[model samples]
Target: MWYNQFRKIQKAGDLMGMTVNKELPLPADLKSEEPLTADIIALKQKRDREIRDIFTGASDKFAVIVGPCSADNEDSVCEYVSRLAKLNDSVSDRLVLIPRIYTNKPRTTGAGYKGMLHQPEPDKAPDLLAGIIAIRRMHIRAIKESGLTAADEMLYPENRSYLDDILSYEAIGARSVENQQHRLTASGMDIPAGMKNPTSGDFSVMLNSVTAAQSSHNFIYRGQDVTTDGNPLAHVILRGGVDKYGTCIPNYHYEDLMRLLAQYQKRELNNPAAVIDTNHSNSDKQFKEQLRIVSEVLHSRAYNSELKKLIKGVMIESYIEEGCQPIGSNRVYGKSITDPCLGWEDTRRLILKIAEEA
Candidate 1:
């Protein structure tokens, strides 16, 4: 009988040995807690407004998104932002600064550092308590010291609430935007949220994410909440698509942008926008190519009027030094302890060049 055959396979370990993966407790539910201060709240609002204005073209200056490719040390992150703040003022009239304060990273394979949660040395799992504290504290320090808004990949949904009072912009990485949970989270986000195309770099998925983020929906939230008002600020970030060879390229061609534009038009997407990432698939993970990508964008803005207004901003992965070091290695410098980043000199040069071109 069919039942007997099924049972034979099950008993042979096809299904009998399966184990249910349990969901670990969120960081917020842990013991360590810190209430967001009024000052932080004010700063968050100010930063959000500034970013919105810049993205919508209400602000005269071009928006330049820059920060460490990935933050591994809290002190180094704060210090880097501090220097950026001083530079931001100089370019305030010509550019708006948005610091990358990403706490979570999406790895291609193997277990990579999940940010402050598994602090490098400690390597602790389910340390939700530490992760929350570290993220909130780092955000607070960056805001207080630099007065610049922070941008992060909203990899974990619950992490958003802990940073509600600090973050200005949230990015949905390529891997998660197509997920129902992420789209739902984007819908309810209080600030601007961006959705990247799928890992394979399919543009339609990005468009779908954009539409979903902007539409109101009834979804479960925080165990008791529902009714997502929709994320109006949700936009697309073209990090490039995989080719026949199955490689990540950071190339967002004019044709790609045009097709995306057409989709936005059909959806009646408000202030339809896109931000180009200079790293990841777009840059083919090459640090130098990132600089060229920005240059090309700036040049395109000057030569192509249609693209000038459409392409709103650029994202760069940069830090104090260039290249990346293996995390487990004992001898790493100020350079990205995570992904390889452009050196500070290269970053400064590119920013100044972009400013001049724009």
Candidate 2:
């Protein structure tokens, strides 16, 4: 009787041509979190403390999370972060550098190379099982080799536990910021999580997300009832937004920052802070314009002490090379295959300049 009922439902759904395709291993089925070597654990803990301190007003160091738009090439990303590690030493007084090792990329149209979390090798077809292992290994290698605790997008809330032990910061992308699961997962995170303003550019939606993330909640996670104590380190990231006409309008200006500050003040949230994403719609995807955006935000911070206090840091999309290329046989090394990004030389100059200003 149960089989007949299932068959009836399946036949009914078949009228719409729906089919269950494949099932992949759960996180527990896949490789477990590797035991952190003493050195890596210490490095991660130290970096996590500095990041949390910045959010909590315990540390005045401006946190800068910079790297490629996606971790398409592991070697290139590792090399890029190694350089950032040396630079971090030079500017330890004023800035906290967290290299981005974002393995997941959210596509607007739901097509294209999804990111390292989908294709460990961009040119190859996605092997999810291999991709999971590869991303974890890459993140671990980045921390072990460079002493830089990295940041990654929480593109899949359920996958957070896979890297929970390794990542120092996590971000809910503009496309996923308004999602209930994303907000709830962030609420459980011990490290800082940034919730970006939605692509629709609604400040209220973003603030509401922050509120949700900073509140305690009980939810079902991985087939079990879990409770979160609320993540007080949840904050905002202003990545600009698209207008109704689909044109990119910037929100990194002094006026925009001030407006965000005003809205944040009215909210009853903890660790009220925001990070200016210099790339994306803010720079109109003109990768070179990121330099100017960063400089301008720094000027705004200098002009208003309150703004300075509210604005915690900046997120820059950068890699070894500048610009981007369509994923194909002839892709450029270190250039982004997703969004255009600032090249290494320009990125270094901007970081040093920001440190000087800070």
Candidate achieving the largest TM-score:
2
lDDT of 2: 0.90
lDDT (C-alpha) at residue 228 in model 2? 96
Instruction: Give one digit per residue, the lDDT tens place, for model 1 in 1-358.
Output: 9989975665565365673333344546432355556786787777778778765767656777788777777887888788788877777777777889888867778477767644533234545556667777788778888788788888877667777656788899988988998898898887778888887888888888888988898877777568988877888888877777987755566666667667777887766778888888888888788988888777766777767777778889888778988665564555786778988788877887777777
Q: lDDT by residue for model 2 over 1-358, one digit each (tens)?
A: 9979976777554536675334556666554544568888888888899899999999999999999999998898999999999999999999999999999999999999899989998999888777888888888888878889999999999987777888999999999998999999999999999999999888899999999999999999987899999999999999999999999988888888888989988878898999999989998899899999999999999999999899999999999989888989988888899999999999999999999996
lDDT (0 to 1) per candidate: 0.76, 0.90
Q: How well does candidate 2 match the true structure, expressed as C-alpha RMSD?
A: 3.0
lDDT of 2 at 13: 44
Candidate 2 matches the true fold with a TM-score of 0.93
Error of 2 at 317 (Å): 0.6
